[model samples]
Target chain A: MRVVLPAGTTETALIDGISAAGASPELMAHTPSADAEILEYGEPTTAPLTPVSPSGCPTPAAITRAVREVVGFDVTVVDAGLTEPTGAATVDLDIDPGTDVRTPTAVPDADAIYDRAHGFGASLPEDDLLIGETVPGGTTTALGVLTALGEPATVSSSLPENPVERKRRVVDEGLAASDLEAGDCDGAPMEAVRAVGDPVQPTVAGITAGALESGAEVTLAGGTQMVAVAALLRHAGVDAALSIATTSFVADAAGDLETTCERLDCELTVTDPGFDRRDHTAMERYCAGEAKEGVAMGGTLSLVPDGKMAALRDRVETVCSRLGIDADGSPKEETGSNTTE
Target chain B: MRVVLPAGTTETALIDGISAAGASPELMAHTPSADAEILEYGEPTTAPLTPVSPSGCPTPAAITRAVREVVGFDVTVVDAGLTEPTGAATVDLDIDPGTDVRTPTAVPDADAIYDRAHGFGASLPEDDLLIGETVPGGTTTALGVLTALGEPATVSSSLPENPVERKRRVVDEGLAASDLEAGDCDGAPMEAVRAVGDPVQPTVAGITAGALESGAEVTLAGGTQMVAVAALLRHAGVDAALSIATTSFVADAAGDLETTCERLDCELTVTDPGFDRRDHTAMERYCAGEAKEGVAMGGTLSLVPDGKMAALRDRVETVCSRLGIDADGSPKEETGSNTTE
Candidate 1:
């Protein structure tokens, strides 16, 4: 199984009102940022992992470690305009580091990145391909893409309490800035992503579409961002042979993900990490809704045997404890956003 | 089709016998050697192309351009270890840049590179995968791998005149430095490559073997070095569904390619570029025996639809004329290997 993490930034996430991803605004602009931590969580030694937002989380890495224990896989990070490198193995797609999504064209080379990403996807072997992504402000980008694709997409949040008003406001401005009406990109999916979507959306969509066309069973691993990708595929008339997999946290979060997936004709697989009872407070934050999901946490968890969540939680606890993170899921030292902005 | 070009260096190429690759030995140590020119040749404009050997030839670019016209594809250069960047879209595999091949271990992380390359291969779609590689002096490394594999392999040279004695001498030293006898690596393919092969060998072998496992038809698109890759596959017991495509220059050169292929259980496809009557004398050098083959020039030409050699030739002439390279296949200025030694 191949996990493609296409990372990008969305200016919508930086709005002072935005905090749904559980990162303190101050830590959001750091080089590795929270988006990169998802890949960082895959390996054990933290020495080479990119320095993520101390206030944010890379929850998906814990889930991926569990899946890896069951069936080993290769991790390939597609540099879809990431602000910083994950320090892992990455394929440079020649995409510029993304600017905030509120630009005239968020992904100017969305077309080229999509074409080359398609070729990359086409080059993989036929198997039960599992694809996952991690873009820090990805949920907001999903909101723009989904709402643009004609879905009432109330995406889940990394925080337990959804920042509905804040996210909705950002999406509203993004939609207005987009030359496209909601359904304008319903026909040409690439256009919507170009207008307001983050770098990860089109890249993941292109790879997913390419793999599907090649006759491989694909699992889109994430929350609303993947739904955004599915929406792009659904409208492009290239939709088939795909499903969405995420955590119960995402499924239970404020988003109407169920209806969104249903509308796109995409299947959903929700894995419960059972964070409610975990002794490790940092991990248990999933139950409290502090760091609900990012990375392919839910999809990766679904791949492992159901009972393996215990082993997975133990690993996370070990990691968190080693890093001196406390039960409240905050870093030992206050690194709130560092945004000096 | 996915084409992976992994490049590296083994100091052995700096020897006087290595001239056919069209690189002045001095420029051979520089970044973006002749290997990169093959991919550059495919594009119509020189802009966006990586600068290769100033004193060398980019003959393969013309051949690859022809193939691109027939079947356009993305070029992914895997930096197995290069002195400098090729400025092309590349995957950094993070293996230590190789020292001279005579080292006790030429590729420090043969196992790691192999594993990662397999993931790269597995990630490709189930199509006719084209796998190519370029490491100056790779033929000597191929000789090392094949002879170590128990094959009495007499490999071809990049020069018009065979550098048999020089290449054989390097292989002899490489073989002796390798702690095992032939078939020592029959059960350990990665070991053979690590001990006696260049950085490109294991990476290409792993990807080829991985793609084969993924049920993709793979074409080892190079000459003797590819033969080395095939030899590694044949011994590893994981072999299936692959072939070697190269130029007649390699086939008809002073090497027993047919017998070697037969010994390794490798199928070969040799394309005749009809270089005999080319106005672009820079390209006709293949006919006269300069720069035999580096990159997948020969194999890429083989993939083009038959009877288009003239169009391919005209395109080459255009590129040659624009580059100011003349009929003598020599640069206007002399850049004899500036050995600071």
Candidate 2:
């Protein structure tokens, strides 16, 4: 199994309460780089940041790393778009970060990035391909893409209590700026991505198409964002069998993942890591519905055996301690409240 | 077999009669890009240029392409250092092109490029990894690296006459500019690459090291340039077994491939494709030693069966005809003398 994470960023993440993918919106750009480094080296050696929720929950990279420590699978990070350079070695696809979704040009090079990623995907060995994504404010773009493709999308947020009105308003502004209405780009999948989708959408969708061509079983390793990719694939007329894997946090969130998967004729696998039964602060925050799912948290969690959850939690705890985060999902070195409260 | 071509460029290729890897000094920078495109698409679409000898002999990319058309192996181009962009999708390692070897910092980011490529190599499946290179004037850099690593060095040239004195002069000037003697960087391999070697060296060496770490059998797919990579690996205290593959043209060149491989404890395979017996201008140019070995021409040629030479020659003839190169490797559309004469 190969975990391919295409990392990017967007200004939409800067909107307060829209995303909790990083310690703050400014730090979100560094999350993908940190995740890549931690997955490869067990810690971030180059970037001074780590992917964390606003409530201090460790990002899914720690979970994936813990699973890798035991399962010994390979991880490859693709730089779909990055505002900053990553210290970790990545397959640089020569893409730039997405602009604000409210702007006319979100991912200006969406088609080109997709074609390039298609070529990259063809080069991989035909194995089980798990494609995850890391783009701050990705769920908002997911909504933008889905609505443009005529799919009514209800996306999950990293913050609890889902900021429904704010997300709808943001997507509405983005649609107006792009001069697109709901279902305007239903038959033109890449156009939706070009107008309002994040770079990770075309990248993950292209890789999936190419990997399918190479006879690899592909699984989108996120929640609502992956549903958007599936929608793109469906609209593009790709008839390959596809699957989506996500955490139960997302399955339980106020999202349209199941119905959308059904409409696209895609499989859905919801893995529950038993976070509610766990005693760690990050786990508690996850249970509280803050930082539900991002990265490949859901797909990677499926790799852990039921008996191995203890080992995985221990690794997660160790990583949190290293980050100076405590059991209540609060920073030990800095004073902050658990935002989920 | 997976062919990983690390494309790069150097001003050393601009030296007269030193490299026939392109139609002219200006076109040399595009040779790797063209080779990558043609290898992926069976023809060049993005760059108008094609890899060709000054004498109009088709570069090794044609042979590799023909073999790939028949065998259907995967081709991946890596942007080790490119002066120009390629139309084909590439695994961008974010490296820049090398300056002239006479400069002190020909490959300033050698160590970092190597480390990044190492990470990439670990991500690949453990199989027989064929690492080829497309760097014009690479043989000169090979000599610089070999001498710096204290290996008794004789490197081949794409030009028929070998331009021995010019290559030696260039290396001497480079050594002086870097304030180093012939054996000054023996124990410190990457230092030599940084000071005088081209970017492809560190990229290939790093990938080889990383692939070896992942339990893959590796073959350096070129003549003198890949030998330089082997030298780098040995000097860095890599104890893994390795092999080198090249065409009989390089084996018969005025070089010390056999002696060097013996000293380095690496296996060498010399493949002869019967270019002398083929009835074609490009094949004749190859037989006359205008373009000896490059772009893994030797390694890919080894994949053809003994009886498939006719089909291979036909494919070569088709490619040459498409390029408007005639029986004598001169332009079919214009008058020019064969440089080998």
Candidate 3:
């Protein structure tokens, strides 16, 4: 019943969900990278910067080492290298040569990333495992993936004070620039990930693969971003029993969730039941029309045994508290941490 | 659009939601009850109080009189009455007549109250009418209704400082006493409401009736409680297109919402896109299944029209500011108001 928590920026939320479930969680941060910068902007701006190494993706070395160090268990990190560099634009648009006049590039490497992420080998232990993600602009990427797949998607930051319009604009622009056609792409799940997916997709795919390989139960953490990752896993021909742990807000936006679950080949579990009671001012502004991607987080986490749950949660909280991130999981906490800690 | 807002204790939330939508609204208070105590509790107590007269159900006379006093127009208040005085308990338990129970009179005349409050006539200026409700312990009733209906209903107060487990217990106890048997009722859309329906049911039923009579679109302004009311209206043979405005949280918990809508025969709208992003510590703690109800209010107001949205939000904010309801929607505001305002 030992749960291994991969350290990511969203530890605050992930940990809270786990700890509240009364599970024992061990927090291990993936090596910090200059590549990923949790950004806080008063206004949306278009600026070109160095593609920081997608350190946001849990490094295989870190994952393996952490598993051995913290959980004292044998674990393997599947290396799914999608982007040439970690810190690429939130979205990568490529023009396929044989496609129409305006075609977007389906990064073959991105497909490889998904494949490798979802392709865990047979050398893994069989136990209940919770898989989570750490990706930058994940919601934006999720929006890109959903839009590329011809589903309306909205990207909202978990930051309390973030402007809804700005987040929506970023997602819309990314999806538009990707040359995604309006028609439904039933197979667009993988394409969406390949076109604009991040490291977390492969990591989650790997976790799914590992679950399949080890015959273990798995839970994907974070919000819509993780759901998109699960979607990518299903599309990659990996059929496994998987669930998501996310806030209630995502569930509301993603109507007809049973259909979505059927399509994704997974169960939907909404965490933070109280989320349904509080006011989400940004719901209409950003998430209303789109199907929610990540609401299954809590229910998924609940599947984890109590001991592991506590460990994962405790570690997450400790790190987040130490980092001075708002334990509530908003990006606002991260803003202060960027320059300070 | 010009919106008329009836002033009540919790009117602030409704007003803010309206004003935020950039609509002009007129606010008027119900004539204060000569002996109205403005009931205040340091902590939510399980003690049942006499049900207040559904006389608060805007009377036709009162509506017309108020319209004349404020807008100088003729208006009607649908009379939805309570069958009996408030039940001795907060929740209505319906066990087998001979079942051994400690709480002898737990099952209140919930259905009778609903029935009594069932005859508010249609709005005269149908297109101009938007109906809303203000019910104390609504989240508890919402939970009861959902649980009775065989849905996994979870309630959480929006009180930041309150303990999650305590809130959940209150809701759970209230729901259990309601004694909702398995399987849907004869004409009920969902079993939850029938098992423990409240005054709001018949009130909104009449509101829907009134709205249809006048050919005006109606908006049910509350969270899960209103949703349940909408459900009850459909069950009572009301045929009208209705829209629901609520916080994203409620929508999230009520998974399979499309089924709920299909059963209820209405459309659902969500306010607060940022609902998921906000750090709802107390709410989430309750969501861990520690508590069944949370003190949530902000999202309830957004159920109104755009014109009324902001005003309702501002009103809530103003009241909270004055009363200091804490970061979460706790009763701190009430305490401050009692002492000062």
Give the 10-residue window scoring lowest on summed lDDT in candidate 2 chain B: B332-341
Q: Which candidate, 2 or 3, has the higher lDDT? A: 2
Off by over 4 Å in 3: A1-108, A152-156, A161-178, A206-210, A237-239, A248-259, A273-321, A324-341, B1-341
- Whole-model lDDT values for every prediction: 0.64, 0.79, 0.36
lDDT of 1 by residue, B1-341 (tens): 64667776666666665533444654655433334433643322112232223334444554565566555564556776666444233556665566565667766688888887787676554367787776766777787777677766777765555666776676667767766666566667677777877777878887787778878888889887787788788777765856888887778774578777777777888888777876556666667665566567776777666677777777666555544455565644532221111
Sorted on DockQ, best first, the list reads: 1, 2, 3
Candidate 2 lDDT tens digits, B38-100 = 776566645656665555677678778888766656566778898876755466678899988
Q: Per-candidate TM-score, first chain only?
A: 0.86, 0.93, 0.53
Who wins the DockQ comparison? 1
In model 2, what is the error at residue A340, expressed in angstroms? 14
lDDT of 3 by residue, A118-220 (tens): 4332222335665544333345556556656655454434332333454445434444556555324446565665554444454456546755666667766
Q: What is the C-alpha RMSD of each candidate to the true structure, in Å?
A: 14.8, 9.0, 26.5
Off by over 4 Å in 1: A19-58, A322-341, B1-341
Q: Report lDDT (Cα) of residue A81, candidate 1.
A: 71
TM-score between model 1 and native? 0.55
In Å, residue B183's CA in model 3 sits off its true spot by 88
Candidate 2 residue lDDT tens string, A139-258? 888988998999877888777777878888888899899998989998898999988888889999998998899899999998888989999999988899999999998999855668
